[model samples]
Target: MTHSLDPAALDQLFLQARTFNKFTAEPVGDDLLRQLYDLYKWGPTSMNTQPGRVVFVRTEEGKQKLKPALMPNNVDKTMAAPVVAIVALDTAFYEHMPTQFPANPAARDLFASNAGLSTDTATRNSSLQGAYLIMAARALGLAAGPMSGFNPTMVNEAFFPDGRWKANFLINLGWGDPSGNRPRGPRLAFEDGVVLA
Candidate 1:
Protein backbone atom coordinates (compact mmCIF):
# COMPACT_ATOMS: atom_id res chain seq x y z
CA MET A 1 0.00 0.00 0.00
CA THR A 2 1.12 3.54 -0.67
CA HIS A 3 1.39 6.09 2.13
CA SER A 4 -0.24 9.51 1.97
CA LEU A 5 1.91 12.47 1.06
CA ASP A 6 3.36 14.56 3.86
CA PRO A 7 1.62 17.82 4.80
CA ALA A 8 4.18 20.02 3.05
CA ALA A 9 3.83 17.94 -0.11
CA LEU A 10 0.08 18.11 0.16
CA ASP A 11 0.23 21.87 0.55
CA GLN A 12 2.43 22.23 -2.48
CA LEU A 13 0.15 20.12 -4.64
CA PHE A 14 -3.27 21.27 -3.40
CA LEU A 15 -3.83 22.73 0.07
CA GLN A 16 -2.08 26.04 -0.66
CA ALA A 17 -1.95 26.11 -4.46
CA ARG A 18 -3.77 29.03 -6.03
CA THR A 19 -4.95 29.80 -9.52
CA PHE A 20 -2.67 32.76 -10.17
CA ASN A 21 -4.01 35.61 -12.22
CA LYS A 22 -0.68 37.42 -12.38
CA PHE A 23 2.89 36.26 -12.54
CA THR A 24 6.30 37.64 -11.70
CA ALA A 25 8.84 38.76 -14.32
CA GLU A 26 10.69 35.48 -13.86
CA PRO A 27 10.72 33.26 -16.93
CA VAL A 28 9.59 29.64 -17.21
CA GLY A 29 12.31 28.10 -19.36
CA ASP A 30 11.87 25.51 -22.09
CA ASP A 31 13.69 22.96 -19.97
CA LEU A 32 11.12 23.31 -17.21
CA LEU A 33 8.31 22.98 -19.73
CA ARG A 34 9.78 19.71 -21.00
CA GLN A 35 10.14 18.45 -17.45
CA LEU A 36 6.55 19.38 -16.68
CA TYR A 37 5.30 17.25 -19.62
CA ASP A 38 7.59 14.42 -18.60
CA LEU A 39 5.94 14.33 -15.20
CA TYR A 40 2.33 14.84 -16.29
CA LYS A 41 2.38 12.23 -19.07
CA TRP A 42 2.50 9.44 -16.49
CA GLY A 43 -1.08 10.20 -15.46
CA PRO A 44 -3.56 7.54 -16.55
CA THR A 45 -6.23 7.94 -19.20
CA SER A 46 -9.07 5.64 -20.25
CA MET A 47 -7.46 2.73 -22.12
CA ASN A 48 -4.22 4.77 -21.96
CA THR A 49 -5.73 7.05 -24.57
CA GLN A 50 -3.61 10.09 -23.79
CA PRO A 51 -5.47 12.50 -26.01
CA GLY A 52 -4.08 15.71 -24.56
CA ARG A 53 -1.67 17.70 -26.73
CA VAL A 54 -0.02 20.88 -25.51
CA VAL A 55 1.29 23.86 -27.43
CA PHE A 56 3.40 26.17 -25.34
CA VAL A 57 3.01 29.77 -26.39
CA ARG A 58 6.15 31.59 -25.36
CA THR A 59 7.15 33.72 -28.30
CA GLU A 60 5.80 37.23 -28.84
CA GLU A 61 4.33 36.24 -32.20
CA GLY A 62 2.59 33.27 -30.59
CA LYS A 63 1.09 35.50 -27.93
CA GLN A 64 -0.12 37.89 -30.60
CA LYS A 65 -1.91 35.09 -32.39
CA LEU A 66 -3.51 33.98 -29.13
CA LYS A 67 -4.54 37.49 -28.04
CA PRO A 68 -7.73 37.85 -30.06
CA ALA A 69 -8.97 34.46 -28.90
CA LEU A 70 -8.84 35.36 -25.22
CA MET A 71 -11.51 37.24 -23.31
CA PRO A 72 -10.68 40.86 -22.48
CA ASN A 73 -10.07 40.07 -18.80
CA ASN A 74 -7.69 37.21 -19.68
CA VAL A 75 -5.58 39.10 -22.20
CA ASP A 76 -3.26 41.12 -19.99
CA LYS A 77 -2.44 38.33 -17.57
CA THR A 78 -2.03 35.70 -20.28
CA MET A 79 0.19 37.96 -22.37
CA ALA A 80 2.31 38.68 -19.32
CA ALA A 81 2.63 35.03 -18.31
CA PRO A 82 5.91 33.27 -19.09
CA VAL A 83 4.15 30.49 -20.94
CA VAL A 84 0.59 29.85 -22.03
CA ALA A 85 -0.18 26.18 -22.60
CA ILE A 86 -2.83 25.39 -25.17
CA VAL A 87 -4.21 22.13 -23.90
CA ALA A 88 -5.84 20.37 -26.80
CA LEU A 89 -7.52 17.07 -27.72
CA ASP A 90 -6.70 15.05 -30.78
CA THR A 91 -9.87 14.11 -32.64
CA ALA A 92 -8.34 10.90 -33.94
CA PHE A 93 -6.42 9.85 -30.88
CA TYR A 94 -7.52 6.26 -31.35
CA GLU A 95 -5.01 5.90 -34.17
CA HIS A 96 -2.37 5.35 -31.54
CA MET A 97 -4.42 2.93 -29.44
CA PRO A 98 -2.81 -0.10 -31.04
CA THR A 99 0.51 0.76 -29.40
CA GLN A 100 -0.80 2.44 -26.25
CA PHE A 101 -3.28 -0.29 -25.44
CA PRO A 102 -1.78 -3.26 -27.20
CA ALA A 103 -3.70 -5.76 -25.10
CA ASN A 104 -6.89 -4.36 -26.60
CA PRO A 105 -5.63 -4.08 -30.14
CA ALA A 106 -9.18 -3.81 -31.40
CA ALA A 107 -9.74 -0.60 -29.41
CA ARG A 108 -8.75 1.52 -32.38
CA ASP A 109 -11.43 -0.06 -34.58
CA LEU A 110 -14.01 0.39 -31.83
CA PHE A 111 -13.31 4.10 -31.45
CA ALA A 112 -12.87 4.76 -35.16
CA SER A 113 -16.23 3.27 -36.00
CA ASN A 114 -18.06 5.40 -33.42
CA ALA A 115 -17.53 9.14 -33.81
CA GLY A 116 -19.55 10.04 -30.71
CA LEU A 117 -17.68 7.60 -28.52
CA SER A 118 -14.31 8.77 -29.76
CA THR A 119 -15.22 12.43 -29.22
CA ASP A 120 -16.45 11.76 -25.71
CA THR A 121 -13.35 9.79 -24.81
CA ALA A 122 -11.03 12.44 -26.25
CA THR A 123 -12.68 15.30 -24.39
CA ARG A 124 -12.89 13.51 -21.05
CA ASN A 125 -9.36 12.13 -21.09
CA SER A 126 -7.81 15.36 -22.32
CA SER A 127 -9.54 17.31 -19.56
CA LEU A 128 -8.17 14.86 -16.99
CA GLN A 129 -4.70 15.25 -18.51
CA GLY A 130 -5.07 19.01 -18.19
CA ALA A 131 -5.69 18.60 -14.47
CA TYR A 132 -2.62 16.39 -14.25
CA LEU A 133 -0.60 19.14 -15.93
CA ILE A 134 -1.76 21.61 -13.25
CA MET A 135 -0.83 19.31 -10.38
CA ALA A 136 2.53 18.54 -11.98
CA ALA A 137 3.29 22.23 -12.43
CA ARG A 138 2.38 22.97 -8.81
CA ALA A 139 4.52 20.08 -7.62
CA LEU A 140 7.40 21.58 -9.61
CA GLY A 141 7.02 24.97 -7.85
CA LEU A 142 5.35 26.68 -10.82
CA ALA A 143 1.95 28.34 -10.71
CA ALA A 144 -0.83 27.57 -13.18
CA GLY A 145 -3.91 29.59 -14.11
CA PRO A 146 -6.31 27.40 -16.07
CA MET A 147 -9.02 29.33 -17.87
CA SER A 148 -12.02 28.43 -20.04
CA GLY A 149 -13.21 31.89 -21.00
CA PHE A 150 -11.46 31.90 -24.38
CA ASN A 151 -13.01 31.28 -27.77
CA PRO A 152 -12.13 27.69 -28.63
CA THR A 153 -12.84 28.05 -32.31
CA MET A 154 -10.53 31.03 -32.55
CA VAL A 155 -7.81 29.22 -30.71
CA ASN A 156 -8.13 26.16 -32.91
CA GLU A 157 -8.03 28.16 -36.11
CA ALA A 158 -4.98 30.10 -34.95
CA PHE A 159 -2.87 27.33 -33.42
CA PHE A 160 -4.15 24.10 -34.85
CA PRO A 161 -4.70 24.85 -38.49
CA ASP A 162 -4.30 21.17 -39.37
CA GLY A 163 -7.69 20.38 -37.77
CA ARG A 164 -6.44 17.14 -36.22
CA TRP A 165 -6.31 18.78 -32.78
CA LYS A 166 -8.85 21.03 -31.07
CA ALA A 167 -8.42 23.34 -28.13
CA ASN A 168 -9.86 22.24 -24.80
CA PHE A 169 -8.59 25.04 -22.55
CA LEU A 170 -5.65 27.32 -21.74
CA ILE A 171 -3.28 27.46 -18.82
CA ASN A 172 -0.94 30.35 -18.09
CA LEU A 173 2.25 29.20 -16.40
CA GLY A 174 4.73 31.19 -14.31
CA TRP A 175 5.90 32.19 -10.86
CA GLY A 176 2.80 33.67 -9.28
CA ASP A 177 2.45 37.15 -7.88
CA PRO A 178 0.63 36.57 -4.61
CA SER A 179 -0.43 40.19 -4.38
CA GLY A 180 -2.61 39.71 -7.43
CA ASN A 181 -4.55 36.83 -5.93
CA ARG A 182 -8.08 37.25 -4.67
CA PRO A 183 -9.12 35.86 -1.32
CA ARG A 184 -9.40 32.09 -1.32
CA GLY A 185 -12.92 30.99 -2.20
CA PRO A 186 -14.98 28.40 -0.32
CA ARG A 187 -15.03 24.78 -1.40
CA LEU A 188 -17.82 22.23 -1.07
CA ALA A 189 -17.32 20.05 1.98
CA PHE A 190 -17.00 16.29 1.47
CA GLU A 191 -20.50 15.81 2.89
CA ASP A 192 -21.87 18.36 0.47
CA GLY A 193 -20.14 17.07 -2.64
CA VAL A 194 -19.94 13.31 -2.12
CA VAL A 195 -22.53 10.56 -1.84
CA LEU A 196 -22.14 7.08 -0.37
CA ALA A 197 -23.74 4.44 -2.50
Candidate 2:
Protein backbone atom coordinates (compact mmCIF):
# COMPACT_ATOMS: atom_id res chain seq x y z
CA MET A 1 0.00 0.00 0.00
CA THR A 2 1.35 3.42 -0.99
CA HIS A 3 0.30 7.05 -0.90
CA SER A 4 1.58 10.25 -2.45
CA LEU A 5 4.80 11.52 -0.97
CA ASP A 6 4.77 14.80 0.98
CA PRO A 7 5.51 18.02 -0.87
CA ALA A 8 8.99 18.32 0.63
CA ALA A 9 9.89 14.86 -0.62
CA LEU A 10 8.62 15.76 -4.08
CA ASP A 11 10.61 18.98 -3.99
CA GLN A 12 13.77 17.18 -2.99
CA LEU A 13 13.40 14.54 -5.67
CA PHE A 14 12.15 16.67 -8.53
CA LEU A 15 11.06 20.30 -8.26
CA GLN A 16 14.06 21.71 -6.42
CA ALA A 17 16.72 19.23 -7.43
CA ARG A 18 19.50 20.56 -9.58
CA THR A 19 22.37 19.09 -11.58
CA PHE A 20 25.43 20.20 -9.68
CA ASN A 21 28.48 21.54 -11.46
CA LYS A 22 30.92 21.95 -8.58
CA PHE A 23 31.18 20.22 -5.25
CA THR A 24 32.51 21.16 -1.82
CA ALA A 25 35.48 19.49 -0.12
CA GLU A 26 33.07 16.93 1.30
CA PRO A 27 33.74 13.38 0.12
CA VAL A 28 31.16 10.72 -0.73
CA GLY A 29 32.23 7.50 0.95
CA ASP A 30 31.66 3.85 -0.02
CA ASP A 31 28.94 3.18 2.55
CA LEU A 32 26.70 5.94 1.20
CA LEU A 33 27.28 4.83 -2.38
CA ARG A 34 26.13 1.34 -1.44
CA GLN A 35 22.98 2.73 0.14
CA LEU A 36 22.24 4.74 -3.01
CA TYR A 37 22.56 1.55 -5.05
CA ASP A 38 20.30 -0.41 -2.75
CA LEU A 39 17.55 2.20 -3.20
CA TYR A 40 17.66 2.48 -7.01
CA LYS A 41 18.48 -1.13 -7.98
CA TRP A 42 14.81 -2.01 -7.51
CA GLY A 43 13.50 0.24 -10.30
CA PRO A 44 12.03 -2.39 -12.59
CA THR A 45 13.62 -3.58 -15.85
CA SER A 46 12.51 -5.93 -18.60
CA MET A 47 12.34 -9.44 -17.17
CA ASN A 48 14.23 -7.85 -14.27
CA THR A 49 17.33 -8.17 -16.43
CA GLN A 50 18.88 -5.46 -14.24
CA PRO A 51 21.75 -4.84 -16.63
CA GLY A 52 23.13 -1.68 -15.00
CA ARG A 53 26.63 -1.85 -13.51
CA VAL A 54 28.16 1.11 -11.70
CA VAL A 55 31.83 1.82 -11.01
CA PHE A 56 32.40 4.61 -8.50
CA VAL A 57 35.57 6.52 -9.29
CA ARG A 58 36.63 8.14 -6.00
CA THR A 59 40.41 8.27 -5.91
CA GLU A 60 42.98 10.60 -7.47
CA GLU A 61 44.40 7.75 -9.54
CA GLY A 62 40.94 6.94 -10.84
CA LYS A 63 40.24 10.59 -11.64
CA GLN A 64 43.48 10.73 -13.64
CA LYS A 65 42.45 7.67 -15.60
CA LEU A 66 39.12 9.39 -16.46
CA LYS A 67 40.61 12.78 -17.42
CA PRO A 68 41.72 12.06 -20.99
CA ALA A 69 38.34 10.57 -21.80
CA LEU A 70 36.34 13.67 -20.84
CA MET A 71 35.60 16.53 -23.17
CA PRO A 72 37.32 19.83 -22.38
CA ASN A 73 34.22 21.32 -20.78
CA ASN A 74 33.62 18.31 -18.53
CA VAL A 75 37.17 17.83 -17.28
CA ASP A 76 37.42 20.28 -14.37
CA LYS A 77 34.19 19.38 -12.58
CA THR A 78 34.66 15.64 -13.08
CA MET A 79 38.13 15.76 -11.60
CA ALA A 80 36.93 17.83 -8.66
CA ALA A 81 33.94 15.63 -7.90
CA PRO A 82 34.21 13.42 -4.84
CA VAL A 83 33.02 10.42 -6.82
CA VAL A 84 32.26 9.95 -10.50
CA ALA A 85 30.04 6.99 -11.24
CA ILE A 86 30.75 5.11 -14.44
CA VAL A 87 27.21 3.99 -15.17
CA ALA A 88 27.70 1.15 -17.62
CA LEU A 89 25.84 -1.50 -19.54
CA ASP A 90 26.54 -5.17 -19.24
CA THR A 91 26.01 -6.65 -22.71
CA ALA A 92 26.16 -10.15 -21.37
CA PHE A 93 23.54 -9.38 -18.75
CA TYR A 94 21.37 -12.29 -19.78
CA GLU A 95 23.84 -14.67 -18.20
CA HIS A 96 22.24 -13.85 -14.89
CA MET A 97 18.60 -14.22 -15.99
CA PRO A 98 18.54 -17.85 -14.95
CA THR A 99 19.17 -16.69 -11.41
CA GLN A 100 17.51 -13.27 -11.49
CA PHE A 101 14.42 -14.38 -13.37
CA PRO A 102 14.18 -17.90 -12.09
CA ALA A 103 10.46 -18.20 -12.83
CA ASN A 104 11.33 -18.71 -16.51
CA PRO A 105 14.77 -20.19 -16.84
CA ALA A 106 14.44 -20.04 -20.62
CA ALA A 107 14.52 -16.23 -20.35
CA ARG A 108 18.28 -16.39 -20.71
CA ASP A 109 18.10 -18.05 -24.12
CA LEU A 110 15.40 -15.61 -25.24
CA PHE A 111 17.86 -12.75 -25.02
CA ALA A 112 21.08 -14.66 -25.68
CA SER A 113 19.86 -16.11 -28.97
CA ASN A 114 19.44 -12.66 -30.49
CA ALA A 115 22.24 -10.14 -30.38
CA GLY A 116 20.05 -7.26 -31.59
CA LEU A 117 17.53 -7.84 -28.83
CA SER A 118 20.30 -8.14 -26.29
CA THR A 119 21.98 -4.84 -27.19
CA ASP A 120 18.73 -2.90 -27.34
CA THR A 121 17.58 -4.23 -23.99
CA ALA A 122 20.94 -3.50 -22.41
CA THR A 123 21.00 0.14 -23.54
CA ARG A 124 17.38 1.04 -22.78
CA ASN A 125 17.26 -0.53 -19.36
CA SER A 126 20.69 0.60 -18.28
CA SER A 127 19.80 4.20 -19.15
CA LEU A 128 16.61 3.87 -17.12
CA GLN A 129 18.61 2.64 -14.15
CA GLY A 130 20.97 5.60 -14.51
CA ALA A 131 18.04 7.99 -14.16
CA TYR A 132 16.97 6.12 -11.08
CA LEU A 133 20.42 6.69 -9.66
CA ILE A 134 20.15 10.47 -9.96
CA MET A 135 16.78 10.53 -8.23
CA ALA A 136 18.09 8.27 -5.52
CA ALA A 137 21.02 10.60 -4.99
CA ARG A 138 18.72 13.58 -4.58
CA ALA A 139 16.56 11.67 -2.13
CA LEU A 140 19.62 11.00 -0.03
CA GLY A 141 20.51 14.73 0.13
CA LEU A 142 23.29 14.47 -2.45
CA ALA A 143 23.66 16.56 -5.58
CA ALA A 144 24.15 14.84 -8.93
CA GLY A 145 25.71 15.98 -12.16
CA PRO A 146 24.87 13.60 -14.99
CA MET A 147 26.80 14.33 -18.15
CA SER A 148 27.39 13.16 -21.71
CA GLY A 149 30.39 15.27 -22.64
CA PHE A 150 32.93 12.47 -22.93
CA ASN A 151 34.47 10.10 -25.43
CA PRO A 152 32.91 6.67 -25.18
CA THR A 153 35.77 4.92 -26.92
CA MET A 154 38.35 6.48 -24.62
CA VAL A 155 36.31 5.70 -21.56
CA ASN A 156 35.84 2.12 -22.66
CA GLU A 157 39.54 1.63 -23.19
CA ALA A 158 40.41 3.20 -19.87
CA PHE A 159 37.76 1.84 -17.53
CA PHE A 160 36.47 -1.33 -19.19
CA PRO A 161 39.50 -2.90 -20.79
CA ASP A 162 38.17 -6.46 -21.03
CA GLY A 163 35.16 -5.34 -23.18
CA ARG A 164 32.62 -7.18 -21.01
CA TRP A 165 31.01 -3.88 -19.97
CA LYS A 166 30.69 -0.60 -21.87
CA ALA A 167 30.38 2.92 -20.49
CA ASN A 168 27.01 4.56 -21.07
CA PHE A 169 27.33 7.84 -19.18
CA LEU A 170 29.01 9.48 -16.19
CA ILE A 171 27.52 11.10 -13.09
CA ASN A 172 29.59 13.31 -10.79
CA LEU A 173 28.48 12.84 -7.19
CA GLY A 174 29.07 14.99 -4.10
CA TRP A 175 27.75 17.83 -1.97
CA GLY A 176 27.11 20.55 -4.55
CA ASP A 177 28.70 23.97 -4.42
CA PRO A 178 25.70 26.11 -5.39
CA SER A 179 27.93 28.93 -6.56
CA GLY A 180 28.92 26.80 -9.53
CA ASN A 181 25.37 26.16 -10.72
CA ARG A 182 24.12 27.77 -13.90
CA PRO A 183 20.86 29.67 -13.98
CA ARG A 184 17.81 27.43 -14.10
CA GLY A 185 16.47 26.60 -17.53
CA PRO A 186 12.86 26.51 -18.62
CA ARG A 187 10.87 23.35 -19.16
CA LEU A 188 7.95 22.79 -21.52
CA ALA A 189 4.47 22.74 -20.08
CA PHE A 190 2.94 19.29 -19.59
CA GLU A 191 0.47 19.79 -22.44
CA ASP A 192 3.33 20.48 -24.84
CA GLY A 193 5.21 17.28 -24.07
CA VAL A 194 2.54 14.71 -23.32
CA VAL A 195 -0.68 13.38 -24.87
CA LEU A 196 -3.55 12.25 -22.67
CA ALA A 197 -5.55 9.16 -23.48
Top lDDT: which candidate number?
Answer: 1
lDDT by residue (tens digit), candidate 2, 57-139: 99999999999999999999999999999999999999999899999989999999999999999999999999999999999
Model 1, 10-117: lDDT tens digits are 999989999999999999999999999999999999999999999999999999999999999999999999999999999999999999999997999999999999
Worst 10 residues of 2 by lDDT: 1-10
Worst 10 residues of 1 by lDDT: 1-10
TM-score of each: 0.98, 0.98
lDDT of each: 0.96, 0.95
Mark the regions of model 1 whose C-alpha exceeds 4 Å error after superposition: none
